[model samples]
Target chain A: MASYLPTPDLSHLKSADYHNVYEPAEDSFLLLDALELEAPFLNDQLQPRWCLEVGAGSGIVSTFLAGQVLGSRAVDFGTCFVVTDLNPRALPVTQATWARNGLALHRLHCIQTDFIRGWRPAAQGFDVLVFNPPYVVTSPEEVGSQPRGRGGIDGRQVIDQFLPIVPTILSDRGVFYLVLIEQNRPQEIISIMRDQYGLLGSIVAQRKAGIEYLYIVKFSRDTSTT
Target chain B: MRLLTHNMLQCHVKSCNDPALNFPLQFQEVELEQIEAEENEALLLNLVGKIDWPALVQTTSELGITGLPPTKPDVVKNDPALMKRLHEILLETNVAQGKMVCRGCGHSYPIKDGIPNMLLAEHEI
Candidate 1:
């Protein structure tokens, strides 16, 4: 299923484009794998009203989900795509990537902000959310100064800040897909979502790519328990 | 940014917060473009139930749009005209460039080439 739909094209992006924005790699492709697996379920049943990717870098991941998972009949489903990224450079890079893929930009709205900070609900809350955060451990002081792919202090500096906001924004049937490394403590992270936020989480897919052992974890409100 | 999106955004600057009127951020010297899209009644119907009509009305007014009803109405499944108007205003009308100012604390966010930059100063957040 991974290669059935080709990984999106990045040939058009100039070398200068990769300076600040994250160049798509194993973590990004790992996320695409998870979304590919969920594509059938997302289209067949969820029919989400709003889908978002927070801290979207290069826009490839959200673009993949839009074309692959949300189905091309998005307008009829009334699904809106909101892509947020703090780096101003990444947003434009995202648009270029989407345009190259032959997807319409009219349906997707890109907002430059810190991880969904000022966004309120539109119609219903977001039903499908994805984040491939900056997960490389670095000093906490260096967190915001860097561009794309540097997570401070156990690689959870950025990821931890986002966890609490998930249960607040996700719809009743909502699901959030997040990518992490082994050092990010997947077990503890899942337990925290379940015990603290009341959102059930499990690792949906995992792979050892290069030197990084990547994991894609999904969280949703457990109807059986809640 | 589209008006539907502007409706969802407000002043996130912690000092000038919500549970207060910081939203429908007043538009100033804006540029708008109408990007045509197909009207989807099913999507509209699913979305209408959750829209905050007053906020949307305020946002449209900021853009000098006065066509929407003062208040949201009951489901008009058969009313194609109303559906088109809603679809047009909410999804089709795009804000290409502008400035959104907070009413609470007078903070401003800029919109350039169609995307709204909602970043605030460190002190604000």
Candidate 2:
């Protein structure tokens, strides 16, 4: 009788070390959800010219925007976005995704930046800032360096860092669209923008995901009030 | 670009305080390619914060290229001229051939074609 031997499973070993293993389903869903909100913002002419996507992990949102901007049936005069992420490895992959989708390479620019410190867009401000921040409320260890799902201790560190810069980076009539977990301090985020940043804000979209509630916020800086 | 190079490139480098070992130079042996294309004004303005414009200007000048715009725009709303200049600086200009050396740390990073080799020594690591 021949000896029975089993092959070693090398599946666990991949050449690259990523902060988070790629999950196509979750990623695609996030993109679709965010787009559901953004599409109307663009379609309704409520800041249709340019957009920005913070925490653009694998470039799914960037790729989709490029297609919408450069496709044959582009709706607006022009649409472009700056995709920013902290992971350097994500840059080329983001670029590749756009190319793979036959989107105009010009419609997207990828950047590597740490949002914890803060970010200043190459442009002073954006018409629309779309953010799907990491909001898993957990301890530091649970949310250390993984770029996709880790938010500092209470899941508000990233949001807090971004709050102060809202005035510095958004157009006068711009809106910030974001999704946060139910556990996140949504009232706190809104109050900071309203009281500190001096912008009128509201939660435009919300959906429950298990125990967490995903939300979309829109803010406008009315110069008349200022 | 070498992390060492990137480290040395600081907005405050013109006037250093302490810990200035990594100041001004770095290396990469890479190919230079310039692809002319439309400049996305919105994107360039967004990148203003991420780029070390002055350092980039100096570095590109060292490479005998005068690509970046002399002036930044007050507003980046649909400005064709600004967009053209931004396009040249961000996309057209390439760091394809040379090594980047830190003016402060005396560290060197080699470049192959247009890609930068940012690996560090074992001890440095």
Candidate 3:
């Protein structure tokens, strides 16, 4: 007799039926993991500052910051997260994230934006910038209408576009936090930021998920006058 | 338009008369918007092989979508970190107000109002 294995059940892991892109159960765990890493960098003293989160998937990271990290804000942190995405279908989940967590609506502002074309912010608007972009490094024919993860050919396309204009969009003293894979040519992205875009930073955290390595990075702008 | 579109674009330079030259249409003017979606780890698993990594990175970087995954993850199953990054890349970034230039032919297609004008001249087609 030959040994046989059953096909994995993938539908259960697909997008939730009610919400567009959020999986409440799965993301809740991921959010906790992100907070575990981000908390040290986002010290409690940094509260009451305006923050912008470019990619607020299911509002997990922001909700974590508001609830677990920020604790209760006396002055409300003046933090306003700008959650953006290309798919108009996913907005409701981000809105519901705060609602589910009992966070105030005033603390969040959602935007349907295209990260590729770039973004414009009010002068000196954000104190912190957080992003978790798609860096799958795929081909054009592959990313067909799928939401949430579409990195082009070399996997650095999104990063290249972003580093150049980060200075322009970020507040002068703003801190940047992000996650990327350690396996691929991440040096390519860092080089663009340091050599080309002028952002300076080192990997602040690292974790292994099975065979893949994940890196948490944080950087600050130079104190020189622009 | 997204970098996915950019990868397919090519310039309609003087000597290149191929129809494929009209690819990777350029953007003229566009209205950008961002929306967040739920995390679909399964799709990330499926799409891992579907994407044009270099083009996606190039277009997003050129368009200013930073903070993406460094490369396509090998084992994306049950990995929270990888899935989280997948959520950000797929749902959060937008491509408004720009055009993709063809690397081959150098033709320009303008994106206006969030829609790409992928039309081509008579000769190019």
DockQ agreement of candidate 2 with the native complex = 0.12
- Which structure is stronger by DockQ: 1 or 3? 1
RMSD of each: 1.9, 9.9, 17.4
Q: Which stretches of candidate 1 lie over 4 Å from their true place?
A: A121-124, B18-20
Model 3 lDDT tens row, A137-161: 6785554223556657655566555
First chain of candidate 3, TM-score: 0.77
lDDT for each residue of candidate 2 in A1-226, tens digit (9 for 90 to 100)? 1112211122332446244423333423544555554665555665445567776666666555546423332323455556666555665666666666665555555544444121223334577776777777777677643545677767887777777876777776677777776677778778878888788777766666566667667777856664
lDDT score of model 1? Answer: 0.82
| Model 3: CA > 4 A from native | A1-19, A22-35, A38-41, A116-121, A143-145, A224-226, B1-125
Error of 1 at A97 (Å): 2.2
Q: Interface root mean square deviation of every model, in Å? A: 2.0, 7.5, 14.8
Give the winner by DockQ.
1
Residue A8 displacement (Å), model 1 = 2.1
| Of candidates 3 and 2, the better by TM-score | 2
Residue A171 error, candidate 1, Å: 0.8
| TM-score order of candidates, top first | 1, 2, 3
Per-model DockQ against the true two-chain complex: 0.69, 0.12, 0.02
